[model samples]
Target: MTLHVHSMLIDGNEVAASDGAVVEVDDPSTGQVIATTPRATPADLERALAASARGWETWRETTAWERSAVLRRAAVLLDERTEEIAVVLTREQGKPLAEARAELQSTVEQLDWFADEARRVYGRTVASRHPDQRMQVLRQPIGPVAAFTPWNFPVLLASRKVAPALAAGCSVILKPAEEAPGAALAMATALTEAGLPPGVLNVVTGDPAQISERLIASPVIRKVSLTGSVPVGKHVLQLAAQGVKNVSMELGGHAPVLVFGDADPELAGRMCAAGKFRNAGQVCIAATRFYVQEAIEEAFVASFTAATRALSVGSGLVDGTDVGPLASSRGLARTVELVEDAVTQGATVQTGGHRLDDGPGYFYAPTVLSGVPETATIMQTEPFGPLAPIATFSTFEDALRRANGTPYGLAGYVFSEDLTTATRAAEQLEVGIVGVNSVAVSGAQVPFGGIKESGIGAENGTEGLDAYLYSKSVVTGLRRLR
Candidate 1:
């Protein structure tokens, strides 16, 4: 499809790249061109920064209620156009249409959450230690923000930064992933239609390094928010440090899912299958490493493999498609390499170990590998695709040691029916978020982030609001008040 793409949004108006160069966006599901976004030049980046500076001046002056009103309206508009936007997302990102719809709906909820939270950016007064003196603490917008969102969850991730920054009264210049830029543009259009003054949310697509360096160097952009890989996040952090800019980063994860011997093997299998295969396991917090207790490993592997093999792999737009193509050829190659390495190292491929060639796109079957050696390549790396490697643990302490062995500390999951055992496991997991008896973590209302090599800072929750705000303390002498 030849899409009439809105290339960029600057200063509240849709515009093209200054060099007239467009980045071709492909539909990973079909290996077809879906849209073209403007590849921003250095000049466009500078303009976006300046525009955000201008926007911040006005946006910061708006009452919290006014800002909340705008964000809430944007949320409503997003809900109204969920299908239209989700179709574009599904086509570009190659997540199943059902998942795409859920993402859009999630984005809507995120926007609404931040909007309501806007009314609660509270500051307080401290009791004066000195007589006749008063001290007050006030919260204020940080300034213009530069946000970079990844392709895996374009709409939802963009909102995670944009909504919170705007709600905290900061104007944002978003550099969305070139591979899936339409969702950002579509969102900008919705916010614009919802009465957002131009420049409050600027979408610029281009060379990430170029755009990021320019934006971070700009004194106008006070904060940077990123959702990408660990390397990319580190690079952004390094650039932002030169300007002393505040940054919020949500980076990589090779999450471990632990199944206790006492846990129901069938239940763990079903939950892990759903969590591992969603978006073809492209999720940052995906359950990539499975460590089932030895007593139940055989049963868990059988049930999980069966469930994974049952998933239908095809075009994301097709109705009832459970698994979609990898978002790029590179992802497919990575998945292939990881699986091949594990197999070559003596791991048994329980099911679906090869790439699907029935079509022209980058589709891989939902694979489940058992007896994955601790030294296998997939065991040491983040398989950001539809491949799950299962290893067995003989004891709870052994499982804990293996789970915490990796440098990644993003997310971890444990399944145990006993409340005490579940709670104990949750505490023992060395990750930012833990799912006990579940694979669902990182909700919109909670703080979402990681530790160690997974990158720094938090997004979502009240802390997310603080990410775009600064606190000011005022001391005054009330000599004549008495």
Candidate 2:
């Protein structure tokens, strides 16, 4: 397996791993080592910190228009080479080519949005109580940042962190997930081609614990942002605490969908099926649990199972593949574990209860389980794969209660014909973002985040840019003497 994009981009140049160590990237669809990324050493991180310190000095001084132009150019370059980058993305991370292209398209749109938003980081003058006093509140860049990104949606998630950081005049060192690192390095390339100066953005893929520790402890790094699992988010929180740093976290989710009796069960079922199985159900905000009104539970389950079964599963590059393999063997095993536990506990397997051994990759059937006992392991933990477990509810309160029972509160879905029921459900779902009649909830113009233990902070929209900036209030005494 060979790599299309070379790795280890530090300061503007592409380099090889120190000590000749490399980590192989496997295509999850085939379970074969597709490419090896150069591993970053602690020494390399030292250089990155030094480079970032230098970058911040110049980057923070640039006019807003200068930064905005670079980002807009990046978006244009990405659009020009959509198929090329999307091919690399699909090969590195097992999402269908079409989905990979869609992710890239979304990332480009986010860049455009944030580019225009760069000029909108406005300051305000406040009234002073004293006649001789003046006060002004301003926003400034948080300084050099260390960003950690996940393998799932590597390019898009990394862009979510990097674009806003740059838009706010913060220099960033991106440590993309090792499993799928090519697309991130490709981003570095795009930014470079778009006229960004050296060291404004850097890419490092290596040992997570080592890389995170060195970057977090560095005095020059003022902010840390991550899009990963909850445990990793907690670990990042602990490390950033030592530095007392500015941080952003977009963590794991076990999203639940509430299907009401008044809604069209068939439509809800179809939408839930698409939501659950996209990216082979590797999405952090993908709907994992379904609570349907008892009157429509059977009908929803029947329709949902049919949609799940209709999906074509295979290598993502294939022409008509609807869902690809799990990103790893660990994810593959987790899906099996959750489904088996539910089945053994007497949950009925409505469809797809086993791995497709008929292939040469890490493929698991998109599974649907009904009558899942609350005691089942899948009910408590996030499967993070193409497994949907549903239960029945008698009332609105009952359905909402079950939906809010999870420790993860990233996103929630509600399908109700009554506007009051939808609004009430949206108000009480205990999530950062709620969709009254939709399951798809992410876009460049909207804020995306979670609540409770799901993680802190938000991304996209105006708030996303604010995360990389800090507010400063300055007051001075003004005097006019005769």
Candidate 3:
């Protein structure tokens, strides 16, 4: 498939913005403009929302079987076109092709899973105190939803919200990140080609603030979902609160990986490094912080540093590259700023520190910062980069305290073969998800999100369905006694 230089998918139309303004989508690997997407205007968003609102009545009335059929067909279509979608994703967002493929495949499975779940959605009947009255609890489509998804995991995160919303019989207006919209557009195309009703799934690409405000303020939109930074999430929540809109947020995370002395030091180092550096360390649940027991700190650091140094940083299109450039120029600048602040604050650069000048693209080498003070900016903030900050601790309680110190608690990890110690730490970790001896905390089958500043609500699994639907209690007269 040839990449379109610029385009936007709105209300099932592959059209350009009315203003005729296009934003360049550059490939971070080559610093070349791969494609251009429309810079959506306020008018564009209103049009999309209006179309969605008008389409919702028919969508909500569609039988569960009909919705499921369309969704399942979409899943099959996604599977067939995974390669093309993955390539577009890699070019737009600087993620490895393999990882992009994995994400795309996962998105297809997510839709299938939700489609199956739609058929199994069950309501229960309860006996009332009086024979004249019986009660039942049921779930129904909420209405048209506004899904605001981040650039990272473009295909997967959008599916995480859209799959459940469509399965639950709600139409959606998706506002994917401006920097990465191709994969989302591709998904929308697949759904439309699979016979989904026009306007049932709308895609809008534009400025975040203008689009978000219009979507949240619209009375026709009853639910809102987002996956992004903490400040953004809070702002969305505040706006949604105005209308009491049902909302689900899967926001930022400063995940910590605790390496206990009891674990294999070498294995722990390898896993932590791989997980942290995946997508060039641009993940919400990326293991940015490494907390190791004092006894094994030296061994873990040596192994981790070696692993980071060996990582191949280059184009995501390259076959052997394990790391790639940050998705956007702004993203690269933020990564540089955070690392520089830590270094200026007396942190030691253990392995990598600066950007590579050999390429036109924005490429930062996998960096590891040691002796980083807890008071440092990087330590306090979510370092959504390839920088790993390792701190040594003498006791479990101290590790627990340090892990819970940050305002953000999205995910936590511990590497310990000892069941007791791992269980204790997992229980005490002040986060929504925890991983033991592994950094793979994300999957379509599991509910993923965070606590505290990480954001509110959850995505994936049956829990995500609640975000797209509302529960109602029905009361009936069991007998005509009157």
Candidate 4:
């Protein structure tokens, strides 16, 4: 298959960098360059900013119904091209084809959800204490937004930012990850074709540092939204502080799964294993730490190991492949290092470990480590790969304490039949999302975000739309009837 030639989208047109420089796009499944995307320069960013300013002026004045119609059409367009874009996504991002299709479906759902939400940007009338006085609270778009998305789920994360901002009548300048630009560019194309005004949604691909610093520092940008690593999020936050821009971050997560003694150990293990290895465990909300009660540790570990070893790993383009290569060599190296560190710290390899040498791709065995010490490096760090660390807990309090031990707290899970046990675990787990007896914690209609260092604000649901809006209080005094 011929890969799509990616380019920067400015003023509703595809163009190369002003200096004619480009970045190579690699297919992780083969470790080969399959395509190239325009590397945006400072001048290109300036043009994008100016275009966004003009776009915001037009977009913010459009009626909410008009915005809703455009977004809904965009969703339909995306749905029609799901299979085509899924191929591009799988080639660049190294996820299984089925998973890539699912991501596209989720992206479509986000646009549709935001489309309906556009018309629901309601205002409220408040009763006035004095006669002949009226008060109203109105929600308005927060102006142009600078959005940054990661490569793990490029199109989905970009849609998470772009769909909501546009639905709120705000134009956006998006800087998608350089590794996987095709899917995001495809989404931009669909939006433009769906009657979105020129410059309303611009996609740029280049050096993340240069793009983020220039865009966030610009006076034209009023809001910043990002889905990336914690360090990158911190850097963006620091830059946004200079302009005092409204910021929303969905950063890194080292999620924990708690398996209580009363829970079905085999069922919990299988579920946790599935959640942990999805997308090769590149997910920010992936189950990284498995904390099982001591009474059921043996059974849980046994089942988890069997389920993990049963997965079929290969190229994303190949059918019947359950897992695919790491998105980059750096990811492969990091996964290897995490497992080695765990073993050195007294952890035992319960299943697959070490890199797979069956091909040239960046593939690692889906690994599981048991008896991991609390001091292991993997215990503290967000291992964004296919590495699972299992540790035993003696009691509920111990499990909660161990689960909340890390600074990151994006998502947590609990599997127990007892209502009190499940309720208490959900309440005490230091996370933005909790899944009891399940790992499906996110949806278009549900609020998705974290507290502590995980993130600053929420996304998805009404909260996601509100992130792009600001409230205005209007008070009007009427002439008294004589």
Clashing pairs in 1: 12-198, 12-199
lDDT of 1 by residue, 372-454 (tens): 99999888878999999999998889999999998899999999988887898899888889998888886789999899988
The residue-level lDDT of candidate 1 at 4 comes to 57
Cα lDDT, model 4, residue 62: 97
* Tens digit per residue, CA lDDT, model 4, 287-391: 998899999999999999999999999999999999999999999989989999999989999888889885769999999999999999999999999999999
* lDDT string, candidate 3, 129-155, tens digits: 987888999989999999999988888
TM-score of each: 0.98, 0.98, 0.97, 0.99
lDDT of 2: 0.89
Which 10-residue window in model 4 sums to the lowest lDDT? 1-10
lDDT of 1 at 332: 92
For model 1, state the Cα shift of residue 162 in Å.
0.5
Clashes in each model (backbone N, CA, C under 3 Å)? 2, 0, 2, 0
Compose the digit string of candidate 2's lDDT tens values, residues 125-190: 999988898999999999999999999899999999999999999999999989998887887788
Top of the candidates by lDDT: 4
Residue pair clashes in candidate 3: 5-36, 6-36
Scored by Cα lDDT, where does model 3 land? 0.87
Model 1 misplaced regions, further than 4 Å = none
| TM-score, predicted candidate 1 vs. hidden true structure | 0.98
* Number of the candidate with higher lDDT, 3 or 4: 4
Candidate 1 — what's its lDDT?
A: 0.90
How many pairs of residues in model 4 come into backbone collision?
A: 0
Off by over 4 Å in 2: 1-5
